[model samples]
Target: MGFGDRWRQWMMSCISIPKLSVLINGSPTAQFGMERGLRQGDLLSPFLFNIVTEGLSSLFQKASNLGILRGANCGNGVLISNLQFADDTMLFLEPRVEYLRNARRILRCFELAAGLKLNFLKSRVVKVGMKWSKSNVWADALLCKEGSLPIPYLGLQLGARSNMKTFWNPIRNSIKKRLAPWKSKFLNKGGRLILIKAVLASIPAYYLSVYKIPAGVANDLEKLQSADGKFSVGSFRIQLEDSISDFSVDHKLVWQDCCPPKVEIFNWQVLRGHVMVRQVLHRFGVVQWWEVSSCLTDSIKTWFQGWHGLCPSISHRRVWDTLFAAVIWSIWESRNQLIFNGEDPSLTQAANIVKFRTALWFKHHGRGSKIPISTMLLNLIESCRESPPKKKIQKEEELIPPFSLGLKFNIDSSARCSPGDVGIGGILRNLLGKILGMFSEHIGVYDSNTAEMTAIHRAVTMCAETPGLIGKDIDIVSNSKVTVSWVNANGVGSLKHSKIIYDIRSCLISLGNSRVIFNSRASNSFADCLAKKGSAMEGDFLSREFQ
Candidate 1:
């Protein structure tokens, strides 16, 4: 509202110069002056609309303050009068004739003052906690249609339980609508991955941001994105979780590299042991057992550590990580060439290809653009040494036990594959670090985020139910920043696991002095181990307490 004169002048200049045209029968009409209102798709339209709507919002506030209007009362004496998003508006008021009349008068006054007409015919008066006849009377007072609960607003159903699968139908339908066009087209694996990542994955983002998607709904969406109707065991979700489980300490290396996405994805597959190499092929019975080489195959973790050991300087580690990805990609490419094209694999050629690819990637994507590829390829180690060393002061963190009278609950989850087996684990302990109780259970099929949230929910519910832990200050710890942040923020930023978040909030409220906090994965090893066990177990929940 305190915009400078220059800002106002610029806005006016932009708004005043609207030489708009229309098309009729594929022919452009002559340009004409826009008499009033902003263009439909203009960037400034939302801002200007918000500014205009603020007047109506203020009017409602003033009316509520004057006791001429009554709004819905939230807990702790908080009252909500109206909510406006772009042109759509929701006014929450008591279902009374006087309030409706006052609202109608306010809308009429706003129409006259702002030169915007109220669309009463299109508007609906939704009544809550009022009889049908009485609600009809109130609607008649405002001269609008009467509406019921669970009405669609801003693409989400209002007044409906978020945990229900039906509440997520809109998101599922939206994704299907977008997928419908792409399904008819024949696409390669890479093309399908790109389409899923860029298009289908984004369809429910808005809904996900607002409401926690149900597990069933998330699974359905994942299935739509998968190349086959069934979930892929080699999906990024499973690979990422698998990498974390296998490496435990160095899993971050896979994503910390600057390689192209396709290469990075390939590297992730390699790390997850999902890549169909000779060993995997033999294990799957695709290759004859006798054809398997006598040479022992090193674990992916062992190979990853070997690469880490090669870089002495921490400054050159990132370049080394990129080189690692390049080398792996190059070797895989050579193997493919030998298998598919009958080309003999050559070690020197693979090394050259790795250097060239690494140098090219660094030249384009990394900070070594000015450095020549020839120089890098000739002496890769020297090229890495040329980059200035960056000193980082990292603060080390560890697990902190709760107050002597309080209890700490560490939670973790393991999701094997997309819509695959999901396991949730939590360990409860006293301030003395003595184990109080612990739980591990396979909780059906769900994504990793949902599994993490379920772990938190299970922990909180268990704490609330424990008679010995009642009225004590509780600390809920998880390695998942998303789960911790969502729980702490009361699920304001995202609704990806809204049902579990809701349960968590309810449990916390009941506990009175409980909080959810995040810690490093290293500190949550017990829960992680328990979760992995649960994932491997068959439909069994393991809970135990130590004296």
Candidate 2:
């Protein structure tokens, strides 16, 4: 059935607002039935042709180790565990690069082990929800036919959760488990400041060290250490010390830039308090928030309350202890933003937002003892404050690829649109910015998703044709991982549009590169911006940019 661009565009305008995300022809779309439409073709490949013999053996062994495959299942038979429709396919071999030597060994192993030829095209590893949860979004490494990053079944996107609530449980539970001892110790008689400081200073320093302030954020810690006195906040006279220091903090004292207030401090030690306070806030935050998502949410309200036959409203008394505290912190920050930066966010409005988001978070994920998925989301935004500056691509650099023989490669699509027209473009570059040529297509009436797919198709065509394009160190970059996964995840020849699939797979087989990558639109803005050019065939594709 043909798709409806007008209706989809109208719906897209309503739900996916422009401020929070990219406004395209529509929400990013994927090639859903790409693999389902495959027809009778030459399945002239070997079973383990994609991986090396040792890699193949190791792949089987890893499955056995994971308890995913054992006993009779381990025999030399081709082990295809999860294959639903022609679309979703997961193999049960040793999906590790450590097991194999170069890409060549991998190809021979497939023929030797499964007696099938390596269908280099249409074969790539996929991870769901790493960047985009849509069917096609994917990491580029998995797209590499040979040198491409192998999507080892045992390994996928790190820290990926199955559902919002369950995902945070382990982290949530671990935090609770660890803090329980400390909370108990603090409540101990004579626990006093020494013990309190010891627990606060050490536990966070050790446990959350992974969440350390990035080097860029702390780059001048030493210089600031000496100048701590210069940046003092109040009578407290705070500053960073080579060794940890302590000063009583009133949560009311410091200011934070986050709309929901953060404590302001003269010195960095405020962060120590912030961490513990935020921990407490987050703990109660999750507890209270989960109640709604797990219960009061509109769709799941009935089911949530119905869980375990308990009165949903009757949650533990302690859950609400810090509920207002978290809200207060948020309001405090928003008020400060309006006052100091003239941001103009009302205190009442800010509190409502915090409440709404907290409730929605729980509706999607419960605030159980486990770390909630929203926590990760929050942290991702917060961490950007400390992350190193992102590298911007230089202009006109990809015209000629760097020195490397035909190495393996992959391509990803990128697109961005405006009110009138949509711009679609694709770039084929390597780790080093060797331009292996790129393509741009424009559809006057298009949504963001369709434009994105067009870019991917164009990129695939370019990669498949030109000689020496086959096995060069290649990487495909796109802002949308969803597009990459949906189109590249399936077997090429299997798709009804077998030619597109075949061309992509053919590029992988021919190239000798590492992998394909899907980046955020901000990072891949260059090609995407290029793709949206002027009206002429070669006019600046970004029609909106000119205006």
Q: Quick one: best lDDT, which candidate?
A: 1
lDDT of 2 by residue, 318-359 (tens): 122123334545655676686789898765777566654444
| CA-only RMSD, every prediction | 18.8, 29.9
lDDT of 2 at 5: 96
lDDT of 1 by residue, 373-460 (tens): 8888888866855455566643321245763358888889986655568788888888777788888998877877888888888888
The regions of model 1 sitting more than 4 angstroms off are 1-47, 54-94, 187-193, 228-547
- Superpose all Cα atoms of candidate 2 onto the true structure and report the RMSD in Å to 1 decimal: 29.9
Q: What TM-score does candidate 2 reach?
A: 0.24
Query: How does each model score on TM-score?
Result: 0.34, 0.24
TM-score result, candidate 1: 0.34
How does residue 324 of candidate 1 score in lDDT? Answer: 90
